[model samples]
Target: MFPIRDHNPSGRVPYVTYTLLAVNIAVFLFYWFSLPSDFALAKFYYTWGVVPAWLMQGEGYSGLITHMFLHGGWMHLAGNMLFLWIFGDNLEDQMGHVGYLLFYLACGVLAALLQVAGDPSFDGPLIGASGAIAGVLGGYLVLFPRAKVDVLFIFVIFFRVFSISAWIVLGIWFAVQSFNGYAATDDGVAYLAHIGGFIAGAVLVLPVLMRRGGAGFWARNQGKPPHPAAEYPVTPSRIPRVPRR
Candidate 1:
């Protein structure tokens, strides 16, 4: 199942979220076009992407932040951006632009540190905004546990969309990451980083939630968006129907 959208609407324009999306895309495109060859691109990634071994050696420390903007492929970038777009706005609305930006960066840094802790000797480049986006998912869960998120589920040839609560969707995601982090033998994906970032995001957002009245806030809003849900026009199916005898 993949999330398509959420029912939560931000009270204000999420300028910071939009800016982050633009910057990530621009950075990816710049590297894609400017790098002379695949080898050159790999070299670039090694230089900028988080390499735990190098970081442990007190080198490439800047990569903790830089690596968040670098993606390994188009699909990687697309998936990260989609998650950021969906969950980021609401968080930003609650935290304010400056606070949210700092929160995002802090989560990324903590995530990189956790990944390094997981395998400090590994030299492979760890790159992607997934850790940071995972943080957003965590924050979203804390603030909007009952918010509706539309997920598209595909099983074999059958496909359908289901609206699920944020708690269910994010809870399952966190569980999967934890399970994979324990089960995987090779240090391929940074599941540890995802777990770390999620925890950090949830922890960091606590003060903000408390200021907003905590349980009282939930009681008032019921974890729904503060604004009216956006209206989406329904379109009639265009596929030709077969007549039945």
Candidate 2:
């Protein structure tokens, strides 16, 4: 299942979120088109992507920030951007543009640090905005746990859309990351970074949550979006429901 969108709407335009989306896409396109070969692309990634070994060696210091802007492939970019588009606006609205931007970068840097701590001897290039975007998801859960998100569920030929609470979605996501991190298989994914970013986001956003009234904030909104949620018309599926014989 993948989250296609959310019913929650931001109170104001999220300029920083949009800019981040544009910048990530732009950077991906620039290197994708400009780099003539796979080797050159790999070289570029090494220069910008976070390499735990290098970072631990006191090198590639810039990768902590730069790596968040890089993606390994089209799907990588699309998935991260989709999450950002869905959850980022609400955060940007709550934190304000400048605050949200700083939070995002801080989460990304912290995520990388956690990944480096996880495997300081590994030399592979860790590239993607997911570490940061995971933070957005983390913050969204704390701020709007009951907000409805429309997730598209696909199972072989069967397809359906389900509107579920944000906490369930983000909670499951964090659980999976935690499981994978502990599994410790060489799957080429930075599960530790995801965990770190998510924790960082939840902890960092606590101050804002407190300012709003801590648990009282949840009492006031009942964990739903602070504003009226956007309504989506339920579309009937083309597949006919068969009656049991």
Candidate 3:
């Protein structure tokens, strides 16, 4: 199941989240524009993407931040932005613009460090905003465990949309990251960074929530939403209608 949207609404505009999305897309265009060929693009990735071995060897240290804006393909960028768009606004509302901006960059930094720790000897360039976006998901889960997230489920020859709580959706996503991190070696995705950034987000955002007073924050705002939830049209089930007399 993939999350389509969330019930929680932002109290204020999420400028940082918008800026992040714009920057990632712009950087991707720049990468494509700079290249004369696909090989040139690949070479650029080798230089800028997070190569853990080179990082550990004290080279390409800047990539830890730069690589967050560099996705490997269309689907990679789409998936990361989807998560960011769904979960980011609420966190941005909670943290405010400046605070949320710092939080995002810090998460990316911690995420890359986690990837390095997981495999310092690997030479592949780890790229994508997924780690940072995963951090946003983690923060959203802790702050709004009961928030409703609309998910679109696709099965062979069938598709449906439904809603579930943040705990179930983000929780399952976290579990899968851990599972894949352990299960696959050559997948080339940094599941470890995703998992690690998630953990960091949960830990780092706790104090902000606590300072606002944990239970009191929820109490004042209600567990449902601080603003109006996004409305969606409920579709009827696809079971064939029985002929009636």
| Best candidate, lDDT | 2
lDDT-better candidate, 2 vs 3: 2
Over 147-231, each residue of candidate 1 has an lDDT whose tens digit, in order, gives 9899999999999888899999999999999999999746467999999999999999999899999998888889865767765
Write one digit per residue (lDDT tens) for candidate 3, span 144-213: 8888999999999799788998899999999999999989656767899999889888887998789878
| Cα lDDT over the full model 1 | 0.91
Q: After superposition, how far is residue 238 of candidate 3 from its true place, in Å?
A: 14
lDDT ranking, best first: 2, 1, 3
Q: Rank the candidates by TM-score, best first.
A: 1, 2, 3
TM-score, one value per model:
0.95, 0.95, 0.92
- Kindly indicate the candidate among 2 and 3 with the higher TM-score: 2
lDDT of 3 at 196: 85
Model 2 stretches with alpha carbons more than 4 Å out? 235-245
- Residue 190 lDDT in model 3? 87
Model 2: per-residue Cα lDDT over 96-166, one tens digit each: 89999999999999999999998899998998998899888889999999989999999999998999999
Superposed by TM-score, candidate 1 places the C-alpha of residue 172 at a distance from the truth, in angstroms, of 1.2
